[model samples]
Target chain A: MENNINDDNAPKTCEYDPNVNQDELIKAQEKQIAEEIKANTAMVGSLDGLSSLEEEYSNDPVYSSKVKTLLPKFSNVRRTRPDGNCFLRGFIFAYLEYCIHHRDELVRFKKYLESSKEELFEIGFPKFTTEDFHDMFMEVVSDLEGSGSIDRVEAVCNDAGTSDYLVVYLRLLISAHLQKNAEFFSFFIEGGRTVEEFCKQEVEPMYRECDHLHIVALTAAVGVGVRVMYLDRGEGDALVSHDFPEDKEPIIHLLYRPGHYDILYKA
Target chain B: MPMFTKLAHKTSTAAKSSGQTAAKTAAAAAAAKGNVTSPAGKHFLDNTRWQKRLQKELMSLLKEPPPGVTVDVDQAHTKLTEWVVHMEGAAGTLYEGEKFQLQFKFSPKYPFDSPEVIFVGENIPIHPHIYSNGHICLSILTEDWSPALSVQAICLSIISMLSSCKEKKRPPDNSYYVKTCSANPKKTKWWYHDDTV
Candidate 1:
């Protein structure tokens, strides 16, 4: 949908040209390298701060053990690395640590995450990940904000034949994880907040349609840090629940009802 | 267990002695009689490599039991392979004292895909979402499924499904449940859009 642009942003008007010359290819590679360096630097603070975050959770010995034990296995499932340098793994663990220390915020975020699992899963998992995913996630967020894609996602989930909850989960997770990027966060917010509002308004209406849906957000400094949600289509309203384990806060539970989707303190 | 071996030996010997047509007929007969391990069943059973792989994996699952569950193979039926399983939920929930039976039918592409699980027995409370046939509408058994997921994982998911139910209601229509479920068994196309508040 983008119009033809000059050399700065566009692909340099290659209508007549079939092949990319050496210089252009080199420039593309350089741009890629620059982006990688930026991502690496942003992740640097998380890599160094992981130990302290782990220690903070150690204060609650039992919960700490549970988190420590479960986090690694979850990370292993989420890991896509053959050479051990995995962004999802490190990112999830860092987030979990954030949740452990900042109990109140963690609880609130966790509630939102749990309630939004079906939406998050579609946005954050299986289909989307790595480089291909980063772009797609940003695009969806932008589309939702600029083009009412948020309302559309919700409508799709609610309408006949559309995989509404799953789509919503995808958008929500993409939004939540993009916390690392302020612009992306804002874009995701426009989409995610709209979807959440729709859930509270339209989706919650028919009780029978809402059963068996649960949303859980999984946060580990390892693995594909995402919100996984399971929706049972066999029953009433889809019952949703989520799990949020972050670095700076104690995990919170976001429980939604007909009128309320609040973050319950889950220490 | 010994009968199982005898069936295998007998089937192989029959395969050697009989013509291809006879062998096929015998296998079909055994399967019709529900003697799945019988020589007749062997000839009629799916002979593809994928079927063998599925059988091996399903057997391993039968041998190792997960928590709060017991799986029993029905010795009576030979044509259809049936497992009658019972699961007890973790304490302090609606399902705590419940005992549910699940039936598994592994089609030709199982293990490489997923087996069909149906609820049997009076263990599960009838809910509007759950068909009387016990087929669930969960994603893991459908499009989101991967070969890495094992039979045990499916069983656990079912158990989890039982434990999560806050309400007890069967599908609004009882007659349609039995007749309508055979087609599109996974209900893969059905999307779960909303959750109970």
Candidate 2:
């Protein structure tokens, strides 16, 4: 067989010399730094005025100007931890905060969530663990049923185990959306990888950061419109905002500053 | 609520355990992992979520194991967190008759964190990716691991790895690696450079 011939000549043997030890040491040190960052930062911070952003960017004229321009449209920001789960964590925090004020939206979202477990199971996720995570998410959503307040939302979002479960479920939703619609998404996936592979490598793993594809999939999957305001050093006097589905009215607003995401409240 | 007594299972991959009879080695490895606390200080055997997940996986493995694989029944009762999975190289392949065993140790963070997996036997297969020290250089065991993968999936992958081998040869640096490598394979920073075994 041609395959056997190819394998005979090209024995892909993995080799690791002494120099490779540096990578392990570096990775361990990075983990140490990440732990320190986690210790110093809250998973989700309390809401604060936009002036904090202004002060953070005061030294850089470009960012300072961008922050000043953002003042009219956004009033405050609630920062999330810089760990890779920030986007997912921040998204749910902001959405639940909005749901607190808008009972109708909360009812609609809960209806969608209640039926998601079966769909995830259908998508071949491990039934037992997936169901466990789904149940945890359901419990959190159910918490907001009666007289839900922002303080209560904040408390639930900051609880370590509960909050992480919600993020994992959200990731599954995105993975499911991508796989279910693989025919269309297959065109967008580069590097010769299939939709299934992309989801396994990028979406299913915990602590893997979200990207534009992730944002697009999550918003489209849940039918929740998100508008992210970019405060990057990219040349701009005003902050640039991109809506998730191009033009759907955004229910939740987020601030994106390079590697991190935080919730934004309208003035 | 099942709290196993604390046991030192740090060197779970030691070849010495397998130098003894297979049945006794199984019990030795099982006894070593009686109780290991997770980073959160919760014992993995404390009927925690990880324990439940492991329990579910073990049940499935026992009920409908993959072909050429079976968990040592004696090890099943000793520890929920550690399992000694006996695997035979797939039939009609380069290693048709050879058998091997892998030790799986699950932390509380699994399936999010990969279970520490390594070959544990006197007859560590002579494969390019498997070192003499019983460390296996496989992507799925390390950086490429996803929570979705299970013990069955891993067994299939390792069997597939052996089944496809064109020749029997140890890794180029097998001796040097065995001398310097850590006991835990997960900590060794494996680079899965070759896929065309």
- Pick the TM-score winner: 2
- Candidate 1's displacement at residue A150, Å, is 48
Error at A62, model 2, angstroms: 0.8
Point to the candidate with the largest DockQ. 2
Which structure among the candidates has the greatest lDDT?
A: 2
- Give the C-alpha lDDT of model 1: 0.38
Off by over 4 Å in 1: A1-267, B1-52, B59-64, B73-82, B122-124, B171-179, B187-189, B194-197
Task: Report per-candidate TM-score of chain A alone.
Answer: 0.22, 0.89
List model 2 lDDT by residue over B1-197, tens digit each. 00011111122222222211222112212223333432212312233656776888888888888888999867866987789999887878888888899999887666666788888878888888787877777767765566667887788778877887888988777776776666777666454453456
Model 2 in CAPRI terms: which quality? incorrect
Candidate 2 chain A — worst ten consecutive residues by lDDT sum?
A: A15-24
lDDT (C-alpha, whole model) for all candidates: 0.38, 0.73
Every candidate's DockQ is 0.01, 0.10
